[model samples]
Structure formats: C-alpha cells, structure tokens
Target: MCRPTAPRRGYDYRALIMKLSYQLVEQSWPLAKEFRISRGAKTQANVLLLALSDGEHVAWGESVPYARYGETLTSVSQQIERIMPLLSSQTSGEQLNQMMPAGAARNLVDCALWDLRAKKANASVATLLGLTPASTVITAQTLSIDTKERMAAEARTIGNAQLIKIKLDEHDIIEKMEQIHLAAPQSQFIIDANEAWSFETLIQVLPALAKLNVALIEQPLPSNNDTDLATLSSPIPICADESCHVSADLAKLKGKYQAINIKLDKAGGLTEAVKLMQAATEQGFIIMTGCMVGTSLAMAPAYLLSGASSFVDLDGPLLIAKDRDNGFTFADGQMQPHSSAFWGGENNQTNVELARLFTS
Candidate 1:
C-alpha cells in the first residue's frame, strides 16, 4: 500500500520547479453500465482534468462538473483558464480557495497544487498533509435505480459486499429494495433519494428502510426544503448530499443531518475536504466520502479523504471501462489506493532540463 520516496534521479532538486503553467482537458469516459438516479440516467462520465505543470513535473487533478451546481465541463474549464493567470509559485491553496468559490473549478486547482507541490518536494501527498498512508479503503458500490428483477440481479452479482448504496425515487417504494435486500442479504445499504422524496414519501419509506437495515438515507428532501428534517425522527441516520458543501454548510446542517457526504469535487478539493471533514466531525456529523462518475484520477485524490470518513463511496473507477496507469484496484469490495505513478505517489519526477526548456 506504500513505497519509499524515489530519488530525484538525474534531476536537480532546486530545478524541479521552473515556473508554473496549467491547462484543462474535458474528458468523456463511458460508464460500464447505465447509472440512473432520481435526477436522470447517464451512460458516460464527462469530466474536466486540470494539469498544472512546472514543465517536467506534471500534476493532475480531476473534477466532474455537476449540472446540479450550475457547472458543466465548459464552465469549469473556463473558470480554470480564467484563474490561471492569477496562479503562480506564489499562489497558495488558501489563496486559491478564496479566488474561486467552493465547487468543481476550485477543486481542480487546489488538488493540482497539492500534487505539484508533492512532486516538487519528492514526497507523498499524505506526508505533505500530515496524514499517514492508508492500507486499503472500503468503497460503497452503487446500485442505480431499476426494476425489482434488475436490481436483485445486479445485487447478486455484486455478491456480499460490505456496503452498497441504493438510488431510490418516489416510485416502487418498498418492492425493489426488498428484492435487493433479499438478493444481497449480507450487504449494508444506504438510500440515496437525490431530493426526490416528499414529506409523505419520507415518512412512508423510513420504516421499510429500517426494516431493510438501511444504514442511512441521503438527501431525501431538496436542500431548500430540508428544514423539517430537524424535527423528524427515523430509525436510520439521515445524511445530506445536495444540502452540504463546504465548511460553511456545517452550521446549517448541524441539526438537520446526522451525516454529511463530502465529495472533493463538491467541497472544492482535498484542501477544503479535510477542513470540511474536521468541521463536520466537530459539529457531530459523521462523514461519508463520495464521488461523481469519473476515472481513477478522480478516485485517487478522493482516496485520501476516505481515510477519515465513516462511509466511503469512491467507487467511480469501478463503474468505468478502464482507468489511467496503475489506477486503484477494487476487489472483494476493498479499494487500494493508486501508486505514486498515478498522481502524487512517492518518487514521482520528470526531466528538470525538459521542464526548464518549457519554462524558457
């Protein structure tokens, strides 16, 4: 799960950082299967990848621009391009956090900075962040909305995984879930309604959700109308997805949600994600690390956040066709983080002379 820092290898330590430059790529990778939610269905993950390089030392960060947040690949890409001139060796994560709002654009820049810095320092990002390396992560595989037979069939295929999240809506209520539960009898379930349920559906589903041993319910009501959650009681814990974002959300989500799902894309990046997780814990909210559908580049950074969370849903790579080199490995429901080669792994380096040439 870990490796020693690789030597500079024919590179001058002082020359690793020549000057800073960045670019963004809009990438679309097809999902392994149809992924449906209360919002809709999608067959591909359209993502934006930001590459910040001081020439040879390239650092990458990925973000999935969510339409729910008024962001698309184009908008986020433009945001990064707009902010590029404002960044340099002088810029800091704190400064970037302020320059951009907490969303996809800022997320890309923040993580790219982390990776670049780690590469320059010739160390792991975990060491830079004052965190220990993690052995393995247990990610929550998703069961998208489907018919009873379809869901049950899929559940059985996943086998007796430790955790599986069910995407539910106001339709079919108990029937599909009951079938799924029967199919994956050994799995723990989390219900993600995606703001589809009403006050009536909320009340109606709680008992069956409890009976099915659903561990949590995620965003059953819309963010704006979730005030009622403060008063309602349910057997299973209620988590906030759409309702929670940065640390600022901790104040409002305190009484309304028992858990908060933190996506690095949504919370900005690992810089803000760590802060949000700390703040969420301080405010008595159990944390769940989640993701949008993307490749291993997205999941690799998110794997850092999973170390401290109660529930982890960084299964984005598992839903895709393939991944970047040495991507995370998911087997027996456990996920091992990617090697340093993929992102900010130990001994990551490039030709300082080539980087110097680019800077020149």
Candidate 2:
C-alpha cells in the first residue's frame, strides 16, 4: 500500500476546507438580449450554479454553457454529477483540478471555492488572489451579427463605448466593417469570428478590417484549423479564444496568436484562470478577459482578472434581459463594480438562496 507524504512546510493541510455542488438553470431572453458573432435566435442560455460550503461561509458561482465547447444543459449536468462526490472531499485547488476535466462544470465549482475562501477570510477576490483592483477598465461592447444596416444602427447606439467588438460570420466581412466604421468612427473596433471563418476567407477579410482600424480579430479560424494561421499574416493582431484554455495551451499558441482571450469557464474556474493569465503574460501574449452570456454570478470571478487584461469583455450580464439584483452596472460604455448584495461586497447573502432556487 502507498503512504501519504508529510505536509509541506508553511502549508495548512486541514484549514479553510470546503465542499461544492452544482445545478443547471435555463433562462430565456429576447433576440436582442444576447450579443454574438451570430445573431440571437430567441436566446436561451443555460447556467450551472456552483455552491461551495465551508463550515461557516457559503459561496456561489455560475457557468454559462457554450455549444462550441460541446456543452449543453444536459451535458454540463452530467459532468457535474460525475464530480459531485469529489467536491466535498477535495482539500486543495490542485486536487480539484485533477478530479475533473477543464470546462464549465469544473469552472463553476472552482470559482465557488474561490468565493468561499474569500468569504471565510472576509477579503475581496482581488485581495485574496494577490491582484490589484481596477477602477475602470475599457470594455468591448459587442454588436451582434446582423445585416450591415442593422449592425450599423446598433453600433451607433453604443457610440460612447471606447472599444466596439463586432461579431462576424464568414460572409460580408467588408460590408460589416465598413458599416461599423462609418457609424462609430471614433470608437476602436475589434472583430470576433468565433471560429467561423476559414484561412482563405480570413486572408480576404483582414485587409479590409485593417484599413478600418480594427484593433484585434479574435478566433477567426476554427480551433482545430488554427495551425494554418502560422503561414499567414495580417496587420491586426489575432487573439486566440477557443484555442486557449489552461496554461498548458500557451506553448502551442506561441507564434500563431498575439493575444489570448481567457474566460473563467474555459480555464475551469478563477483559480486556474489566474494561473493561465500569469503564464500567458510571461510567454509574451497580450491578455483579454471575456465571458459567455450569463448573469452577475458568472461575471464575478472574471473581475479578478480585469486588472491584467488588455481588453475586458465581461459584458454578458448586460446582454441579459434581466440580471441578478446585484449585477454589474454598465453605463456610458463603462462597467462598474457590483453592489454589496453580490459577491465581493458587504451584506452579501449568507445562505445558498440562489442554489436552492435552482435545486428546488
């Protein structure tokens, strides 16, 4: 039989322990409620709420499902079911990482632990994680993919935004960029293809987008097909969204992408998200913090990384028809911190009311 090793120096093996569990919730919003490279078709987003239980404090986390990641409500529930047994037994973040594959389920559970830890210690997530708080970070407000005229109209409405993230499909690359530039000439533009374009189409599109002063183009090619990018070049920097997850992906993305968009769900949670951010920075990749469509709970952990990112795209809550009571406040194209009723704030809920809402 194998024996456990002695505890490491300066480590508390038994202190600050917690247990976590998850539930799936499906929410429906109107067409304009979701912003993406593809227009919303009566948006319905699935969220997995992660609840962490310390002896005295409880924390919650939410994960938004993305179809591109092979995740649906049923699939995420199954993933969580398989790992439920380990949530209460795992003693450390490293141990939790080994128990589940990196994805939305793990992300929610991982973030909940971070929240639980923060509450137990009465510290903010940033302070607990050794990161500084940002007063106001420039965020990219997304314009959903639509007809050039419609997209232009949407862009005009968000004219106060400093950076505009335009969603594009393989078609109408020039027309969309032209329309957006004409409408919001003063705003910096960023294009996200969401792994929808091919190398040939990307080549055909970059020159027009570059001329329009697009600051960045994200995930133009599908993740599996990204190797083809090394052979091509463009004026606007390319950022890897689907291509990057944990720190393990950094070596593979070296010359292919100038930046990487880090989402809490993709990194499996805020704990690993921070690790991946530091690793990406050391490897010389510009950082962007992004999110899938969900409420304030989903965006909370990502706020911890805003200080290190060049582009902040945690606008998911803003796209929802209605959000949690303490959801982020977005106005004049700027995102403000959540109020005390949400995570990282005073007077936060002491019980798992959100979790019970989904479970019941």
Candidate 3:
C-alpha cells in the first residue's frame, strides 16, 4: 500500500493573472485596419488597456478585440466589472489566475504586473525574467486577406518586411498564396488560417504552401477539432494558436501540433508565459511568441520571450494606426524592446516618422 502524501507547503501554484482593474479604451483607426476575411464589421478593434498601480509603481498592458473567442468591447468590460473587487485584494501575479477564468482581462493584468515589477526593480523586463535583452526579433508583417491583385499590391508596398504573414480562410488559398509568393518571392511567407480550414482543405493547402516555400501554417483546424491532426501527413508543421493558450494547454496538444504560438494574452501574463515556453520546449514543441493588437506597452513583455521562440509575431503594435509614447521600435518586421521607454523618451521626428510610415 502506498503511504499518504504529506500536505504541500507554500501557496497553491495555480491561481495567477488575477487582481487588476482594466480600463477599456476605444481608439479609432483613420482607416479600417483590414485583414483577409474578417469575421467582424468593426473597422476598429476595441483595445482593453489594463492599468495595475500599487500606490507607487504602475504597469500597463493591452488586449485585442477577438469575436471568435467570444470577446467584444462590451463583453470584456462586463467581465472586468464583475472581477473589479476581487482584483484589488490580490498582491502577486502567481495567485491571480484563480480569481478569474483565463481570458483577456487576466492577460492584461498579468502583463501589467511584469511591467510594474520590472519598473520597481529598475531592470528591463527581459532581465527580470532571467533572459538577455535582444537587439531585434524578426516579425511577420500581415497581408490582409483579399483578391490576388489587391494582395499582390499590398505585398509590394510592404517592401521592408522580411517575412509576410498572410491571413487566409478556405477560399482561393492557392491563388492568394501563389500571388504573394510570385510578387514577393524573396520575402518569407507564413499562413494563419484562424481555425478556418477543414482536414480535406488542409491536405489540399499544405502541399501548395510547401511548394511556395511557405514557412509555417498556423492553427489550420479549430482547437476543439484537433483529433485528426496527428494522424494526417502534412508537408509543413502546423502550429497551435487558438488551440494552445497557457502552458496548461500544452499536454493535450502533444501529438496534435508541432509548435505552439505563445501569446501573453492567452497565457494570462508573462509570468506564466515564461513557464509556458519552458514547458513547450521541454516537450520538444517549437515556440512562436505572438501578440494581439495593442500599444507598445502591451508588446514589451512579449518581446522579452523572443530569445527562445522559433518564430516571433509581436507585430501587433505595428498593426495599429497609432501607439502610445515611448513604445518599442519595430522596423523591417523586427521588434526591439526598449530599455526605459516607460520612464523617459519624448516623441521626436524619428518617432513621428516611424509612426507615420506604419500607422498610415
């Protein structure tokens, strides 16, 4: 007979990304930020910027508006409203998750804690996380889903981008892929299906993607319907985006996906995200760290995780029409974390130029 296990010491290790009041900011894009095959009608995606201030130190984070995840400007705000009382009582990031279920609110608060901690220590977020600061991490410039002609034109315009992430659905996939590949043959390509492809379509799409030298395909099937993935033979490794959130989502994805797209919002914060990266790597899954649409403050923590990631898509800040002051630098599809933007750094001519070129 097995002996009874002793009671665990210390705090229970599950509840994290909790305790933080969120402020939902509705900002407008001068023009509609279009993507290939959008599911919503919003020209502007509502950004929920979280602020976690513990009297002296303050931190900020952002969450993109995703309707597919059952998120909206109103819904996210309502969720935050319900958890407002619970957030103010918590002290550390480790005990935040249990306060509220995993979603964007926890993501923002979790990220804010990392920022607040980094600021209070007077260290970069990377240093705080035990990772070295990186000069640059290659990012994927997105080409909005559209007709071949329109897409080719957009591809030509983003001449500085090293890699182009083309958003796709099941329709005219080869036509769109070939158009971009033909137009930007030298530019590397990655495809994100957003869980829109069926197994049959994936079989049809993967071969063409490989032929075009497409680097990777993201979340081809819906997260709940990944059972068929392991059995099928494919030309390219499929990464889990919607399927994999925090490290806890890893074990179930073992045979189903070759890689995981780690997003701070999905991981609930950078604290768990670091652990998520370690767990994914230990399990032999390649990491691709990404972000949803938000400001530079939101992208900062995700930048810290890039060193170990196989692919980096922290280009959410790049997609916005405007960003807050002292945001991180992103040029030619690469993201560089700032040393002390939150502390100092006035907007200047170069910053204006950077903003105009991308934001326009």
Candidate 4:
C-alpha cells in the first residue's frame, strides 16, 4: 500500500495531470550462440519494448515474454493494451501494482513508468531512490547446457571469471560438474537447474557439487516439489528462481531456500523489485540479481540492484550477438555502469528521438 510521496520543492505538479501516450514495439535480437537450459534452447531474444511519453520527455522499458511463465508476446501486448486507458501521468507505482498482476506485462509497463518519473524529475533513478550508483559490478558469466566437453571448454575460455553460472539438467550431473570444475578451478560456480531436478537427483548431486566449489544451486527441484528441501540439509546455498517472484512468496520460501533470484521480469519491474529486495534482506535471504536472456536495455534497470546483491548474473547482453547503441560495457566479467543517456536518468534528447522513431 505504498503511495507516491509528495512532490519536491520546485516540482511541476501539472505534469502529473498531462495525458500520457504509449507505444509497444516488438524486437528480436539474435543470440551469439544457442542458449540451452533444462526446458529448451533459443537462438534469439524476443522482447516487447514499451515507450511512454507526456508530449515532452520520452522514456523506455523492455521485457522478455517468457513461455515458462505462460507469457507470449501477443498475450503480454493484450494485457498492456487493456490497462493503457487507466494509465496517466499521475499513475503511481503502487496503483500500477494493483492494476496489473505481476509478470512480464506488468514488468514492461512498470519500468517505463519509472523511467518517465525520473525524466520528469530531472534526476537519476538511483539518486531518487537514495542509492549510490555502482561504477562496475562483478557479474556471473553463464555457460549454457551442452556436452560435457563443450561446457568444460567454455569454462576454460573464461577461466579468469570470478563467478560462473552453469545451466544443467538432471543428466550427467556429476560428470559435467567435475569437467567444468577441473577446467575453471579458480572460479566459483552457480548451478542453475531451472527446476529440472528431482528430490533424489538433487540429493545425489549435492556432495559432488559442494566438493567442486559450487557456491550455489538455483531451483534444482520443481517449484511445486520444493517442499522436500526443508526436510534435508544442503551444503551449498539454495536459491529460488522459479518458485519465488513477489515479496508475498518469501514467506513460503523460508527454511527452503537460502537465497532468491530477483529478475525484473519475474518481479514485474524495479518498483516491486525494490520492495522484494528490502523484504528479502530483512528476512536474511541472500540476494542474487539475475536477468532473462535480453539486451542491455533490460539489464540497465536491474543493474541498480547489483550493489545490494551477493551474486550478480546480469550477463544477458554478453550472450547476445548485438546490443543497442550505448549499451552497457562488460570487461573481464564486470559490467560497467551505463551512460545516463542510455536509461533511467534525466531527460535526454537522444532517448526522445529514439522513442519517436519507434512510436512513429
């Protein structure tokens, strides 16, 4: 029930009453390689980009419609269109939360609203939220599910990485872990099963994974079957990805997962993401900020959470073949802060022009 705060001194309240215009654009960015996980593989990142304008400042937001969450581009678009008439310059984040259910559709609109507010206020989102912007953050470089040899080779290629996340299924669990560990012994590992493991498989692989310096295990068991985790003790920390979304889900995850993965797409956007992060920290859950396979545009807002996260997995741009102009820069596994003009900052003529191109 958090409401918008009172306007600051010199703020123009009239802007809040202005009529808002919006446009939804579909974009497809090719992946550098096939990204494989327990569910399937994808060669490209299909996203829905949302643009919001108040006849002056323009703001942008992007979200990936994941089939795993029963979200498709058409369905997400319809959800946004249905809610469009309710949105105005006066809409508050809390109001939006009540207006739409948390998912990819809400994520796209929520982020666009944040960007719009920041622009109208002539401030950065970080500054408005009272957070110090990070210059660079250590991000996990992910190795997709593949043959043992190929996965090991990929690990070796990024041997200097501080954190490496490996996607795995229920098959050849120990063998793949051993091979990848041998190839990158210096690097810590995060095993992301994407809910492909059973209680028996997870128990069997725990010892081997612990010995291999695996720092964490992500969603090893299906969301519905994860109650089994509370019954057994695990060596490495367990993180909930698919099982946990909004702050309301945290109560059930207690004693089951040591951590939770906060993806803007999953949390619905930065607005809810901030609430979830604060609640998760207060409950002593390890924070891991992650992302769906997306371009830098999607990562920009999520990057704001890196300072508070113990594990950062915002390497979606690294997996993509190309990124938007002025995208975030990644070097030796660290993602440098993006330009203010790129996203989540004061009004920029460049972004307004870009919005015009997409919306026109």
Candidate 5:
C-alpha cells in the first residue's frame, strides 16, 4: 500500500526547543462575482489564518470556516484557543491530528505545524515530505450555477481552459450541460451537484451527462444517501466530495464512488490528505485534489497533492477579487508553483513581514 514517506534523516529535533507562540486572525476576501453552488451563494470568502512561531522564524496556514460543516469563525477560533495551552514547540503534526477531530479548525493548526517544521529545517515541505515539486498543474476553472444562457456565456469566455468544473442544481441539468458543452466543446467537464439531486434525478441525467462527455460527476446525492450510488452503473466516473473526507471514508465509499475529492479543510490538513491519497490510490480510486474558496495560502499546501491527483481544482484564488501579494499564478487554467517564501519553505524576510501584517 502507498504511504506518506518519513521525514528525511538527520533532522535535529532538539534545536526546536524554543517556546512556541501562536495567533489566529480572521479576514474576509471579496469574490469577483457571486459564487453559487447547489446549496447556496456567497460573495466573500471568510478565512482564519494561523501563525506559529518559536521566537524567531514564523510560518502560516489558513482555513475557511464552512457553515456546511457546522463551523463558524467564532467556533473555529475557540477550537484553536482551547488547544493552545496544550501546544508546545515539540508538538508534531501527527500528534495534532490525533488531538483534534477532522474539520477546518484542525486544518489550520496541522498545516501551520508543517510549515513551521519546514522553516526550522530550512527546506520546503515537499522536500521534507520527499516529494518532487511539480512545475505546473492544469486546474479546473469553475462556473457557478446560473441560467443556461449565462452559464454558456461564462463557458465561452473561458474557452481556453483545458478543464471546466460546473456547479449544478436539480433544475435544467440536461439543458445546462448541453449549452455549456456547445460553448466549450474542447474543455473536459466536471459536474458538481453538491448533494442537490435526488436518486431519481441522478438516474435521469446520467445518460445525458455521459453523452456530453462529462469527465466526472461529483456528489450528486447527499452524503447521507451515498448508499443509493451503489445501485448505479454510471458511464462517467463519479467522485465523492462531501461523502468522503479522511482515509477511513474510503471503505464506505468503495462500491459507490470511483473517485474521491481531497480538500485540505475536509481532510483536516495536508497531513491527513497525504494519507488519504495513499489509501484511496491503494484501493483503486481516482483522486482529485480540491479546495474551498479562500486564498493562495490555502491552496499552497493542497498543491502538494497535485502530482498524485488526476484532477486538480485548487482555483480558490481565481474566484476572489484580489489575492495576497505572492499568490499562486494562473494562466490559461494552469497554476504555477508558489515561491518558496510563500508558505512551505525556509523562513525568509518576506515571511516575517507577512506574519507581522496578519498578526499586527
């Protein structure tokens, strides 16, 4: 079975004895346009940033408090605050994973610890994880749910994207897919129903979607109704988003889903995400690395899973009105690797300034 490789040998753990300090900052980034999914719509991305320091080098991580998962900014902050007293410079990511349950609160802390360790070791997180950095990855540009005409217009506007992810609801499933396919015939499509469709609706739309050459269908039924999928004989691959989280969920999803979407927040951070990837791969499931709407800080760590994923959807920054100074760069649906100083690399003057800006 595939597993997360151990950290490189000869790392001096004793040198990290300095007392640890932490801060949680809440911020909101406006969206370029309304981002709508099957469940609802939002105009801004509300995120909590975590900063971990040991009196010298500083590292950062971010997570979006999703109400869909019973998390609000206040609750997430309280979660981190409750655990602050128990944390120390020596606390490892694996230990943090055990101390907290899987959710956005644990996601920030777990990711920040990884960044902190990488900074202390003067190496990138990928280097510490024994992963080769990817030069660039083709990310799926998303088109929010809208009228068929407008959705088609948006699809035409992003004609250059190699992959397009469409957010859909129960209404007009066939019409919308037909319009979008006509508009951007060259681009492969991923239809995300976000748990809006009923089993009957899904049964009705399967053949039409398959005809459109849809690459994947994501979470067409509510997570509670995952058993219904075991009855399906879908032509296109079906990926589990809300239905799957950590590696443990894979067994339950075995006959239901052919693919799984790994989001850092849902998986509790990259630490568990890597393990989920390994487990899902071993079980013969295709992997798609996904993300919540946030910023480059959120996407940077998730990017590590790109090389292992067949479909990459780390396009959070692209939907926002503006991103941080050193966000990931996207061109023609391709995302380039972030600068080392961004998050998971050796500490630099820029990182120190970034921490100051967020903590000040």
Candidate 6:
C-alpha cells in the first residue's frame, strides 16, 4: 500500500501536510429556452465539473462534453477517473498536457489545476496569471437556427446586444438573415453557419451574406472541405471555429481564416487557449473567444481571454436556466468577471452547493 512520507528536520510542515486531490461530477442544467446550431438542438446543458482541493482550499472548473466532438458525459467522466491518481500540486500544466489528450477530459483537469494553483499562491487565478480583472466584457448573444419568425423573435429579444451571433443553415439561405437583419438592424452580426454550407452554398450565398452588414462569418464551410476558403474573396471577415484548435493549426488557417474562434473547451483549457490566441494574433488573425453550453465555471477562465480578443462569445451561462449562485453577470449583453468568491477565491459555502450538484 502507498503511504505518506514525513517531513525532514527544518522542512516546512505546510508542504508535507498538504494533499492535492480532485473530484469529477456530471452535471446538467436546463436551457432557458431552446438553443440549436447546424449539428442539432439541445434542451439542457450537460456538463462535467472538476473540483480540485489542496487540503486547505477548493477550486472548480467545468467542461461540456460536446457531442459534436464525439464526447458524452459518461466518456468524459471515465477519462477523468483514469487520471485521478496522478493529480497533485506537483503535477505541472505541461505534465497534464502530456498525460491527457486535448479534449473535454484534458480541459476539465487543466482548468481545475489552474484554480488550485491560484489558491496555493493566495491570489486570484487572473492575478496569478498576471491578467487584469475585467470590469466588463462585451459578449455575443446568440440566435439559434430556427424558423424565420422564431429566429426574428430571438434576434429582437437581443436587439440591445452589441454583437449577435446568428446560427445559420444552408436551407434558409436569405430568409433567416433577411428577417433577423430587419429585426435588429442596429446590432452587428456574426453569421455562423457552423459547417452547414457546401462549396456551392458558399459561392451562392457569400454575396448576400456580405451585403447583410455582417461583422463576421464563422465556419461557413465544413471543416474538412474549407481548405479552399483562401481562393474566395469576402467583404466580411471569415472566422475559423471548427478548423482551428491549438496553436499548431495556425499554419493551415493562416490565409484561409481571417479570424479564429478560441473556445477553452475546444482548445482543452485556458493554458493552450492562451497560446492559441497569441499565435493567432501574431499571424494577424482576428481573435474571438467562444464557449460551449456550460455554466460560469467554464466561461470564467475564457473571460480572461476576452481582453486579447476582438470579439467575445462567452455567453453559455446566459443561455442556461439556472447558473451557480454568484456566477458571472451578463446584463444588457455586457459581461462582468465573476467575483473572487465565484471560482478560485475565498468562499465558505460555494463548495457545499457545488457538492450538492453531484448529489442532486
């Protein structure tokens, strides 16, 4: 059996007494309303939370096991369980990166480690990482793929949002854009096809989509078929959501994608996401930080990326029915970073509620 070793003479007792541990839980939250994209629709946001403890303080991180990426809640939880014994304060981010493949499971553990390290250093995660706490972040409000009327109604609801991300499919063509544009003429739009368009659709609709005063078009072509985007010209910028993952993807996307959507979930966590942003920015690609449908715990780390990005799409918590108490605030589409008590900072009872999420 394994055993704990005692500290040597004059050794700091705190170092020897402290233990690092983690717990993984499956959680689901109902959507405030329907949210759909090119892939499908979801009524609830299924998520996995990784809670890390340092025998003194606890911190949390959350990840959505995106079905679009072939991940489900059960698969994500089992992946976390496999690496439980290896989690420790001594395990560096580099070590974690080497231990797990980049996906939902790595994202969960990597973020939890960041939170725990902030606690160990007695600083907020943002502070520990040398980032300013944002007073407010402008986040995109999404209008899911739907009938013209429903899409229009949803667009109208977020008429005051500075940026509205409109999910599109190949079928609607001009109908949905016409309605949503007419409904919220004042708001800038991100026309996100989410890989629903074909080469012909891209050719046929680029002109009309350009005329809609769209600020950006995201992943209009399927990830596997978008290699030729560089050959086409566009008035509005085209962003890469599915095509770009880690920093290594930049070479393939250099001339093809004008912008890259950096989501913590997709990049595996903030550690790699930060490297992705720096790499994308260096290559002159516009940066947009996005999110999967998760709670504030997932979006919080991504919020730190907002300062370095031109467009911020961290609105997952906004679409969910009930977020954690004291989660990040989104009012009038303007985001405020979560309080220290929300994630890595001091809080007495938040962990109790977080624990209950696993039980109830």
Model 2 segments more than 4 A misplaced: 1-42, 345-360
Q: What lDDT score belongs to each candidate, Candidate 1 first?
A: 0.81, 0.75, 0.69, 0.87, 0.87, 0.79
User: Cα miss at 308, model 5 (Å)?
Assistant: 0.4
- Tens digits of per-residue lDDT for model 1, 1-360: 111133224423223223776545566787788999999999888887666777557777888899999998667867876778677755778888889999999988888788888888888888888765358977889999988899889999996698999998889979988999999988999889999999888988788778886998999999999988888977888999999998988889877789999998899988888888888888788889899988788877778877678999988888887665578898968998776667866677643422332454
RMSD vs true structure, all candidates: 6.7, 8.5, 10.7, 7.2, 7.4, 7.3
Between candidates 1 and 5, the TM-score winner: 5
Give residue 87's lDDT in candidate 6 (0 to 100): 64
TM-score of candidate 5 on Cα atoms, chains taken together: 0.93
Q: Global CA lDDT of candidate 3, please? A: 0.69
Q: Which segments of model 3 are wrong by more than 4 Å?
A: 1-32, 87-90, 343-360
Using Cα atoms with residue i matched to residue i, what is each candidate's TM-score against the true structure? 0.91, 0.87, 0.83, 0.93, 0.93, 0.90
Which pairs in model 4 have colliding backbones?
A: 107-268
Candidate 4: worst 10 consecutive residues by lDDT? 1-10
Pick the winner on lDDT between candidates 1 and 5: 5
Which lDDT value does model 5 have at 199? 90
Can you list the residue pairs that collide in candidate 5? none
Q: Write the per-residue lDDT of candidate 3 for residues 140-245, one digit (tens) a residue.
A: 8887678888898888888667888888878899998888887888888879888889988898777778988688889988888989998977778889999988
Residues 53-89, model 2: lDDT tens digits: 5545556778876777888756776676666655662
Task: Provide the global lDDT of candidate 5 against the true structure.
Answer: 0.87
**In candidate 2, how many Å is residue 10 off?**
43
Please give the lDDT score at residue 232 for candidate 4. 76
Q: Write the per-residue lDDT of candidate 4 for residues 208-268, one digit (tens) a residue.
A: 8889989999999999889999997999999999999999999999999999999999999
